[model samples]
Target: MLLAGCAGAPPAPAERPAAEPAPPPVAAVPGVGVEERDWLPPLFSGVEDEAHYYISRLPDRRFVTTYGGEEHPRPWYIAAERLGQIGEPAIPLLAARLESSDEYELMLALYALMLASQDPSLMAATGGDTLELGSVLDPRHNAENLALARAWWQRQGWRWE
Candidate 1:
């Protein structure tokens, strides 16, 4: 009678299968292989406001280094892509950066500016043409392109406002 009573107790609800162990939590240590979240430059630290912060980061070398860093796009490149998506709003900032940057930085600035503006003349006059080896080695044509771009911007200052 005791055995019969024990058997009737619903078979102890059958032992449940053991669940798979959860994956280890991912922890990214700062300055290790992981990129930092607060990657904004010191130049943009005192920006007028949030809008200007985004504008200021557009020209920062740390945000968008040259194409030789890694196989994957760097954090700055991704940020530049986001800035490019903002279109005309990015132009004045990019223009200012273009005026001040060096050749490699100029390449990055002009490329981002061209993407942000998508203006045909700016494209035709600057991005469309390739700088030869000598031109790349020098800033003469880059200066010319800068002047041309700035001139165009001056002509269309009304649009920028």
Candidate 2:
């Protein structure tokens, strides 16, 4: 006769807990379909609205300070300054402006993009080899600038956060 401990067959294997489901895939564009406007406080309705206001006012001429100490129109400087300060959050909105037929808007958007991202390559893409604001804003280079800016946006815009 078999011993009491050895008589019974080996016990069945213990059951394992069910495996967890895989997480949902993330969107290629981080904020693709969400209503970003609703998330902000009432003072500023949305980033787009704020960006539009500043972009609409981008100056045709650069602000200059006189030797006598008189400052040029501060509003002009302020608009570009604000856009620059908005940084990456302002990128997609600025990129949308790239398709406009208006050279002013296109240039302003690209300029703001350069300022926002602080990416010298964006300015370089506009054919401005230097970081000087004047070189990037020069209207003489508009066609080449727009073409290159558009190409850059095509390759890199969606990748921005």
Top TM-score hit: 2
Question: Per-prediction TM-score, please?
Answer: 0.45, 0.48
Give a tens-digit lDDT track for model 2, residues 117-146.
664544455454322233565556666766
Q: Which stretches of candidate 1 lie over 4 Å from their true place?
A: 1-9, 12-51, 58-60, 64-79, 101-105, 119-141
Give every collision pair in model 1: 63-76
lDDT of 1 by residue, 62-90 (tens): 66433436676434354445445555566
lDDT of model 1 at residue 78?
41
Predictions: Cα RMSD each: 8.3, 14.7
Candidate 1's error at 109, in angstroms?
A: 2.7
lDDT of each: 0.52, 0.58
